[model samples]
Target chain A: MEFYQRDRTLQPAGYTPIYKTSVARSPRQAMLSLQGSLSETTGPVFGQNELGPLDNDLIRNYAKDGDPIGERIIVHGRVLDENNRPVPHTLVEFWQANAGGRYRHKKDTYLAPIDPNFGGCGRALTDENGYYFFRTIKPGPYPWRNYVNSWRPAHIHFSVFGSGFAQRLITQMYFEGDPLIKECPIVHVIPDEDAINRLIAPIDLNGSIPLDTIAYKFDIVLRGRRSTLFENRLEGN
Target chain B: MVQSLDYLKETASQTAGPYVHIGLIPKQAGFDIFENNFTNIMADENTRGERIIIEGRVIDGTGTPLRDALLEIWQANSDGRYNHELDRQKQGQIDERFRGWGRAGTDFDTAVYRFETIKPGVVSGRNGLDMAPHINFWIVARGINIGLNTRMYFADEQEANATDPVLNLIEQTERRKTLIANRDDSGPVPVYRFDIVLQGENETVFFDV
Candidate 1:
């Protein structure tokens, strides 16, 4: 896999122009939402929260508190570089549909009515070492326009926070072979060769374990050299 | 330089800061534009995701990621729709790409992060008008928590930005700083890299909250 090293000198085509504009309050307000103790060294802070609204689908199944299904994935891992160095105290969050493709939020309407047995969202906070995770269900692929023919693969959404306001990233993760990969407009936006091998969930069909207890592990590596970059497993064509 | 650094440090404690002056951001690169890259908030994944390679380093005023510093970005989906339950359209159809929201944290040396997402679509402005494509960004650094309600537009989007109501609101001089549409129709993925600095050189940016 070849990597496109950015030539800082080389410019992007028709990039958006910047115009001077006045804003409401000062930028100081930006950091207000965070909980930082000035008395403390400005190190990373990790946040924890209970599982969000269990969607109708997740509800159908009996939810036991300590069950592995309910047992927190404890998504604890460090965001490392190609060299495996830790990126300090960054902010992280994730959201996905219930196991059945429905969201706990009021936005979605694609899947069949409701399974009444799923949880749609979870959030994680990284400790001083830049790591965070959310216990969440596998998001399902749904249909939309912009692309003449296609639906996105079931996947999770991740947002990484950093340095300046523009230092942010929002992207999706797909299950290996979700069938919706081929024509996704976002996937279409990239040349097939340049697109990284996508990450996907392996099926636990044989079920060496009980039906209710199942797990899949996926690792995420951010923008880097393609050789070291994880391949994007295309799905849902 | 060392003496001045110390002096400025003392001053920052008493001063109003660049955000109050409103004059400092213009001198720096990666300034703010009301329309484009980081602006719209999405309700869900499909219509509001921001998929792009965000590469840069953490540095003190000299240039760096503040390696230990953290960054957060939130925006609307490709269809210019957010995943918020309240943002439902008149048709009762939840906005596509409104994958509502998402977040990622930085690693020890990992200053850069990227996402695979479709480009966002045009959106309705606060004034009930049009806006160019953009993503919203929230950056957290040392004592600097800059909220930039900015946007990143494509270079070839001249025709689009021209009619964009938000872009039209600004005066021409400031407009160039806000809009980042450089004419690079030939590059790969039509890259739009916007790096931010917390203080000094190119200071971190701020928008009207």
Candidate 2:
């Protein structure tokens, strides 16, 4: 199947002058010019047989015990290709902070208390319909050292693996109507307002289980560079 | 408000952060969710070709080793064929035991990553030219917004490396050496040392794909 071609403009320019560290090692003109010639090599060959059923649950680490200490929520969505086709059996991994805004990581110096019940990580493979669902808690906003008094908006990190090596994407999904989104340097790096809006997942009441859990829908669209329209089109013929 | 009236733009990229290791490889991160690493080995004892070791450290621009970097490698089997359905159609038989994909996180203390696999054979490149035996590498770390894509070629395969379509495409001859892993046969097993420098004068060539 023909996948979406790589779109240079839609991707963040490596040496974005705004992001400070980007200046240090970001590719210069020479390296940027060479990237166009690099072709897709071997893609991954993963299948349902290679996966386990328990891989999908974020709360599975505490399965033998009680629930994790947080607001229970279900995050569900489909993994679509650039052509709008469902990508089945692809791996979708997630990592995020606990409801208290603290991570289970060692380097995370956030002062919030760590919830022993929450492991804060999970993985799920898309089904035949390119659909995946995660039983996770609502992670809280956390502070970072990016700048003085800079607190990252409540967000979950997502890593999606498509059919080929070129299709791999790592992005963060923010909650809808988060006030912190406007101040986020990472989110603003995209340069396109519409694309930034796409990263926010709307609250899906329909997917919620009434009293037990709330649900958020986040559909990921993999890169497909088939559509390329030039600027300044002639007046409608 | 000027609207482009075109396709949807691709999503923005972000760093893998310090939590990537905890999520992906819980065992390595001390969580111990799984018994073994997600991708500890690419090939088994029954796999074909000469067994080799690829070891290297990921260094940042400041010359400090990136301890948080997570790396994943995909390559062809000893027969120059991948275990995927597409390659299997072309090469017929594939080693059942060879997964042809492995993942390793940089050691917390040493900041070095290692992978053990057999030597990959030449594969057909773009326009039917013979490509060099190379292992594809994907690297992600704290400061890296997107995963860096690169390839590791063999230094001993000078004949094959000379005609490699991808290597030749590199206009600068000196920059091409960054992709070739120098072979050290002095060890018990053949070792190929390929250090990846994220930035600086000897920054490894990272592909945009």
Q: Provide fnat values for all models in the order shown.
A: 0.00, 0.32
lDDT of 2: 0.76
TM-score attained by model 1? 0.38
Best by TM-score: 2
lDDT of 1 at A190: 27
lDDT of 2 by residue, A29-111 (tens): 34423222113523676665555666666676545467777888899999887667787888888888889998887767778
TM-score of each: 0.38, 0.90
lDDT per residue (tens digit) for residues B113-159 in model 1: 33334555655553344556655544433223222334446555677
Query: i-RMS, every candidate?
Result: 22.7, 7.3
The lDDT values for all models are 0.37, 0.76
In candidate 2, which residue pairs get closer than 3 Å at backbone N, Cα or C atoms, i.e. clash? A4-A224
Model 1: which docking level applies? incorrect
Encode model 1's per-residue lDDT on A64-181: one tens digit a residue: 3522123222223444332233445555544455455544433345654533434333344355565544444455566644334456566665444332222233444556666776
